[model samples]
Target: MQFADAKERVLSLHQQLQEHNTRYYVLDDPIISDAEYDRLMQELIQLETSFPELQTADSPTQRVGAEPLPFFEKVEHTSRMLSLSNAFNREDLMEFDQRIKKATGLDQITYVCELKIDGLAVSIRYQDGIYSLGATRGDGQIGENITQNVKTIRSLPLKLATPINLEVRGEAYLPKKEFERINKQRADNGEPLFANPRNAAAGSLRQLDPKLAAQRALDLFIYGMDGSSEVYTTHQETFRAIKKLGLKVNPEWKVATSIDEVWEYIEHWQLERSKLGYEIDGIVIKVDDYALRTKLGFTAKSPRWAIAYKFPAEEAISILEDIELRVGRTGVITPTAILKPVVLAGTTVKRASLHNEDIIREKGLLLGDHVVVKKAGDIIPEVVSVITKERTGEEVAFHMPTHCPECNSELVRLEGEVALRCINPACAAQIREGIIHFVSRGAMNIERLGEKVVILLYEHKLVSSVADLYYLQKEDLLALPRMGEKSVDNILSSIEKSKGNSLERLLFGLGIRFVGSKGAKMIAEHFGTMDAIVHASEEDLLAVEEVGPKMATSIVTYFKKPEVKELLSRLQGANVNMTYKGPKIVHANDSDHRFAGKVFVITGTLESMSRQEAAEKLEQLGAKVSNSVSKKTDFLLAGEKAGSKLKKAQELGVTILDETAFLAEIER
Candidate 1:
């Protein structure tokens, strides 16, 4: 299409999308289906692709930036984002009303009561009604610039209705459903879970990559605008104005004419919070009129016009029903506490990890004892402590079992380790765990193939080892309970795709004793091929920076096994990638090499090359490229959007160089 025609289509699409976004996010009603909205966005993307000149910052398709930032730069707020004082009970709210009435000499002062969303506080600025900058509230005065990250929030408008300059404050939150989804994914990938929705939202916004932030499904609720009465007199009127300007405001906000009304609003929300899609910790009460807020100005850290009423802490007590022992992928025996169901943190608490035998002893845990329970990070169930006074004489003292529950082998406590391990190599439990680890996120990253599926495959006598996964057929998966045509296809596709992963992933997935992901990467890079690593002597293995004597011995011993040799042969036959794709870093002590043994750190977007490519280039030339900058860093390669790391480098007096300088030095 011609540029003029494309531009017209793009403008039309933008208007349609803006209306749909407002309808869905602000009004909680969507006129179009998600598929239909995606089709429109796809059309806009195509038009913009053909006519790059028509693409603007405010375009809906431009939500996620093309590149990630190195670090967040500091931004100054036009006005301080003051916090609110706390109100614990009805007496506190009544006291606040009396104090304000006595000071202002007014009767029945009207207030705006809003739910206090448990999220990150952010300031968004607009220039001529177009979104310009977004920032986190750091110490009220200065904040980190998160403009790119915040732009990914779908509910936030890129351009206001009227072309007028304004700034608004909102709480950026991860919805309860999204939080649960993220935690589930993290659990599957063997990553730590965020304690709650608040932490999840904060972590998402702070992500360096705009693409990552966009995937988090973050939402915002605009509470206030700086320099009140700029467009409206009352606080409630300000909400109306911003809504007209295409901003999202919390619909639950109510005008309270008296302290009784405020208390009633709080009481209603306190009971209704669990039913809502989002998380709220308290209620925010603000004086309704802008004039009244101005008269009752600022406190040192909080506003005299408003205060937050916190809810009771989320906790509960449950009875410890029983203890269950389980074996890990590495044959490490772990204990789990089975609890009588109790409601906490919007979910029922049933079980908590004991981690190992030592933790159970430390907590003085007993079967049938009443235990204080809470969700750790609001994701994992945890037994905080045993209520000694609530313990009955019928409660049984718990002890670690002497043997593996699956293999029936005698467990051993390895030297310098607290956990008991079942060392039997042919242990069925260990074999299943090894396969599970092979398909995990940091390894092959085979999606949909979870622990339960792996257990099913083993129990059904279909697969014996990790290599056997490659041989699974469509019929085999279709046989599993609840496995349908589409789900099985996806799992099979994921398994096939994992075959092309680089050598580091395979090495890590191999579950080599004493060798972690970093060590595996270094070893892979050093040898350049799986064959070389398997055949390498201890001395050759020791030459790698991350490999030590214990690690080298372990690697050598692992490869020497006949069964491992057979597994490798099968994997090779299956056509899995066996070679490192990056430039080899080990150079056998070429002292004349530039940057030999010198530490280097790369930051931001490099125009000439990707960060990983640059790291490989430096590593090949004998430099140790680190992720973080410190006093020991010999050089810092800075590119566009470099911020915190660059500042820290300067503070540490490390040698700082732009991309040009870095390229010149490395090339020479």
Candidate 2:
């Protein structure tokens, strides 16, 4: 074929594939079957291969790049990505109204309320309608470039309806079904599981491999846009414009002219949030007028005109069936309450964390007793209190296990911590839990090798260590009960695939005491590879940002173990990749700010800024921001409608600051 003809055909293919992608991924509606789409993609790939000059970054085939990067490049945002302050109740919403009226000198204020999606905030830039850049909201001013990863989100438009420059911000989240499916897969693979949809979405977005991000089946909801070229009079108009541009936006938003209407919207969503496929922790209320938002201005962290009304913790009543002791990777014995099946929020609750013996005793939890259960942040289920008045004589008092449930080792409470721990490192339960953690979604994420399979493998002595997983044979897996050929093959394939995961996943999977996923990623990026990390001294680790003395000691101690050294060697021999593959955390020197070294709890509603904005300002000034008020809290920044947190702060003798005082202190 002539070169000219080939160029025309390639252009056509690119347009067709992009449109198909938009329909299938973004719209969740496809005109063609998967097979048909594959055929077209194959045709485009062939054409591109033959005419390499015609290839472009926007091509569908470019989703999975040739190699993962050493680290992400930092992209400074055109505008700061502000965080919202929160309101917990109706009173807080009314106070928000009062603040708006005071600021604008208007008796009544109109507010646009949208779902506060429980997901990662991201910004996507488009040039002349074509997608250009995508980034995370890293510290507001600067963010890590994730353009390739964002491209895989089908709901996001690669090209807009109009040829205009735009920067759209949205929440990238895993739908409830997808979150459950991914967690289930992780559980099956005997991997550490994602705590919730939000975490899963964040982890998926941070993946060095865009292909990995794509497989996560992520969705997006574009809420607002940033750009100087376009103007919209109101928030509702902007939403409509975003929709017209072929971007997905949540439909359940309302414009309330009065605080009562705002409360109405909040009340409706509190019940309806559970019904949505994705999680919404709260509703974001903003002044409907863009002019008003501009006039109200932004604080260091959030827009003063906007506030998120967070839903109260959801609670339900259930019967406690029994108390089960579960040993962790660290050999902590946790008493989990087995409950009669009950629905809490939108999910079924069969178990709730009893935490420890002290909590169980404090709440007088007894087996077969009726109890109140609640999900903290709508994720973790825990017993709130026991319904002792309703308890019959048949109910039995609960007891903590004297020995580890898995290893029969004596359990002891540590000097200061509330947990009862089994010090035996070689405890079978610890080993099992460790392996499960290693394979979790946030870790190596080996699919299909789940809890039952891992236990089965261990019982049969087919696999006992994380490294042993690489050495697994198909025939050995096939020997297990109900293990079919297909399942064995799938597990083998997943295990092989995990070998390509960057060091962070492996590091997190290792379950180093006191090291979390964020720390693992930071350490992995700072060190560059597993070898560098293994050889890193305490001083070297200490130099890394966010690494404390305890964490540094933990790393050094963990690596020095002969078993760990050998395990690393085995993983190396098995050809697992060990290098860091995401953006390195840049260590910027902290400037001395007034609130430095203080601890803050932001409660109620602030007039000057959103709760997040206030927290960010406090954090910027070197203050530690905590969710709950405690004895350690230096100050409770209270606003109107301050509830339990305020009361708790008062009881704890924590200092309280009004919004005016908070602003004054920060400014001073």
Q: Using lDDT as the measure, which candidate wins? A: 1
Q: What's model 2's TM-score?
A: 0.57
For candidate 1, which ten residues in a row score worst on lDDT?
643-652
TM-score of each: 0.53, 0.57
Clash-forming residue pairs, model 1: 195-377
Per-model C-alpha lDDT, please?
0.85, 0.82
* Residue 192 shift from truth in candidate 2, angstroms: 1.9
Error of model 2, residue 126, in angstroms: 1.7
On TM-score, the candidate that comes out on top is 2
- Model 2, span 1-668: residue lDDT tens: 78999989988887888788777766668999999999999998898889899887666777656455555677888887776776888888888788888888988788888888888889999998888999987546667788888888877767777888888899899999999899899989999877668768877887887878888988999999885214878888899999888888887888888989888888888887778988988889889888788778876446789888877787899999998888888988888899999977656899998888899989987889999999854447999988888977999887787888788888898898999999998899888888888887778988787888888888888877899999998888888999999999999999999999878889989999999875786688889989889899999999886699999999999999999999999999999999976543433245466566777898887776888568657755667777877658878887755555754564344666767657877887
Question: Model 1: per-residue lDDT, tens digit, 337-401?
Answer: 89998977756678887788888899998899999886633346777888999866998898788
Kindly give the number of clashing pairs for every candidate. 1, 14
For model 1, the local distance difference test gives 0.85
